[model samples]
Every structure is written in C-alpha cells, then in structure tokens.
Target: MSITFEINRGDLAKAITIALKFAGKERELPMLCGINLSIIKGQLTITGTDRFRLGLVRIRPIPETADGATNPDLDGPGSNIGVLPRATATRLLRVIGGPLDGRSPNVELTSSGRELTVADGETRLTVTLVDEKFPDVVGILLDEMERPIDLDLWGVNTALFAAFKDAAWRKGDHATVRLSTASRPAVVRIGDHFIGCLMPVQIAKRGSTASDWKEFLTSEPERPTRTTKRASRAAK
Candidate 1:
C-alpha cells in the first residue's frame, strides 16, 4: 500500500535536525543509521539512533484555518511510515529544509513499496527506502532506558571542546587544564585553578575508548583518558 501525507517543512526539518544527532554514523549498525518517520495514533513520530543515543519527537500535524480551526487532512490518526537513509536525510534537509521558517510550504511525502518521495507539489525528490525496521524506541525508553536515571557514563557535546580550548588560551597561551571525569558537568581545571563546568552531551561511554552497548540500552562506563585532548597537546 502506498502511504502519503503532507508536513510543514519547518516542523519536519526541525525534527529531522534533532534526530540526525542520534542517527548512527558508523557502519557497524547499518540499519540504525537512518531516520525513521512513522505516524501512529494521530501523531507523527520522527526518530533516529545509533544504538548509543536515541532521539524521537512526536507531532500532531494540524493546520490552522482562518477561523482558528484545525485542518483534519494531516491530523495524524493515519498510518504512513518510512525510513530516510543518512545520506537521504542530509540531502532532504539541505534541500527543502534549508532556510525553513514557519511560512515554509508544506511538503508532500509518499512512501510506496521500497521508495519514498518528498516534494512540494512541484519539484520532487524520490529515493529508495531502507529495508531494515526501526526499533520500538518509545517502548525501550519506557522500560529498558528509563528517565531520571543515573549512570557513570555521559555524553558531551563535541562543540564544547572549542570553549575549553578558548578558556585555556585565555588563561595562558599554553595553559594545561585538568578535566575531572564525572557523570555530568565535567569540571575543567588548570592546575589548582578551576576553569568551568560543561554539561554532559548524549554520550554512550564515559571513556575515550569505544565500548559496545552491552544490551541495546545498557553499557558499563569505562575509565576516562588520563590526559585530555588539550592537555596532551600542551605536553607535546
């Protein structure tokens, strides 16, 4: 059966941007590397994961009428699902998603057989879909990966590394900082001097070395590297 629907570019693009972060980058889990778009119970859910981190967002797609009423055309309550490969997601985001604002037109998405197409009723992009099935992330999160949980391991945003470097440079041209290995808000220090604290990003392991997710959503945190990136550079 061919499943078809329309979604606001702004909403869909924003959701895809967040989901891309969780999408698998490695080939180890080829199936988990793509973005999953599914509609269930009148809600559109977009998800992406790399076995280490999972991100999903639900949207009850509805349109606002002149009288402030809701448009029932895409008010969820429908079934249409597809997986956009990493490359495809990137391309789609770059194409229709770029410069997207609330006024951006709605995009039509059609999934038929092994193909998925995204267009705005004029120019269209039709690509082949992945064969792998997306896992029930909501179910997994409800049980296996519960909220308000504590673990030794934590994820850090790679972007913050620059700030750490900037702080060290500001302190001294070649200041050597000691980063404390903690679960959240990793403390950055320069000798006995405290620099700042950075929150944990969505990381799988606390260690520098790669570790498998023991059982899907579970992992044993490993000891962090003795020397941080900037520290090692200063030592050299």
Candidate 2:
C-alpha cells in the first residue's frame, strides 16, 4: 500500500540523532545498521544501536485522521511504515533540512524487493537491509543501573564538549574529560581510551547571595609519582 507521511522538524531531529549514533562503520551487514521505526500504542519508537549504546526515541505524531478508522488510529497513522536503515535515514534527514515547502514537507517510503526508498520531494535514498536479525536492544537499555550522581545537564554538556574539542590537539588516540563532585570526579573516555579531565565550573556572584567561580581546565597527562626525566620534560 502506498501512503504519505508528514515529517516535521522535531521528527527529523530525533531521527538524525538516533541514526548518527547507530550507523555502522563496518561493511559486513549493512541492513542491521539502520534505525528501525515502528508505530504502536500511540507512540512512534525509533531504535538504533551499535551493540554498545542503543538510542531509542518515542515521538507523538501530529494530529491527523486516517481513512480506515471510525474514531482515528492516532498511534499508527500510516500503513506499512517499515524500517529505514541508518544510512538511508541520515540522507533523508539532510534533504529535509534543505529548502523545502514547509507546508508540504512529506517523506515517502516505498518498499520493493527487500529495499526501501526514502524520498523527500525530489531527493531519494534507497537502502537494502540484511536478513540478519536485530539483537534485543530494548532489554539492555531497561537493565542499565541507576546513576548515583545528579548531573547539571547544561553545565556538564557545555563543559564536556569544550573539553573534547580542546583535547583534539593532543597526540594520541586516547582523550577524555573528567568532572568531579565535591566528593568525587567524573571521567570521560574516548574509544576505550582515557584522554583528559574536566572539573565543574561554579559561577560567582555578589549581593545578598553567596557564590563561587569555577571552570573546566585541560591539564597535562596524569603523571606517575616517579617519572623519567624524558617523560617529565615532554609533558612540560
């Protein structure tokens, strides 16, 4: 069955976020690498994972009436809305971000011979899915242990990105950012490697309220208590 689905900015953003995180770099099984989109129980679930970090997003669709129902199938608005592999979804999102008729921003999905075609206006991307089964990703997400620390999201994100960018110039595959609570420090690792450290930045203020000023600093490598002169000189 052929159907049309309207894609808004929110949906596009969510799709892109999941796709970027899960798209496979290896060329073995290409189809298992795409984001799977399924509509159920009034919620659209987008899932993507590289067997390490699985990203899932549940989005509510815009209010629209389908032809087959008495009240309305608000949950699954379109028929046969199959999965779009990661590569296809990424390209589709890029096209959607470009110049388009805002009033009629629609993505057409057509499945033929094990391939799915994602089209936005004149641009189209086709992706083939491998027959291999997708692993049970949802269960893993559900089983994650609760984090102990309460994070300052805005502060942490800003500090973390800044720390990563600063560490880019360092010579090595390993780079990390570490943040500490009053009691302990948080560490950031890149690709099974430790790179750098980050400290929480506190803002200072005057008047009736008291405050303190703090900033995240990039430091030299964590040195051994007893280090060779060559290593010490290189760090300096």
Best by the TM-score measure = 1
Error of 1 at 194 (Å): 34
Compute each candidate's TM-score over C-alphas: 0.56, 0.48
Angstrom error of the Cα, residue 15, model 1: value is: 0.9
Q: Go through the candidates in order and give the C-alpha RMSD of each one to the true structure.
A: 13.7, 12.2
Candidate 1 lDDT by residue in tens digits, 1-236: 67665667777776677567657778877778888877766667777766545556565554553345555564446553767889998888877766645433677667788887887755688888788877876565444323343455556677644444533213454434223334434434433211234455655444643354454468556766676876888899
Expressed as tens digits, the lDDT of each residue in 105-194 for candidate 2 is 545445454566666566677776445555554443323322355433313336334434322223564544333332233344444211
RMSD of 1: 13.7
Clashing pairs in 1: 42-77, 155-201, 155-203, 156-201
Flag regions of model 2 displaced more than 4 Å: 1-5, 28-32, 65-83, 101-103, 106-128, 143-223, 226-236
State the lDDT at 152 in candidate 2: 36
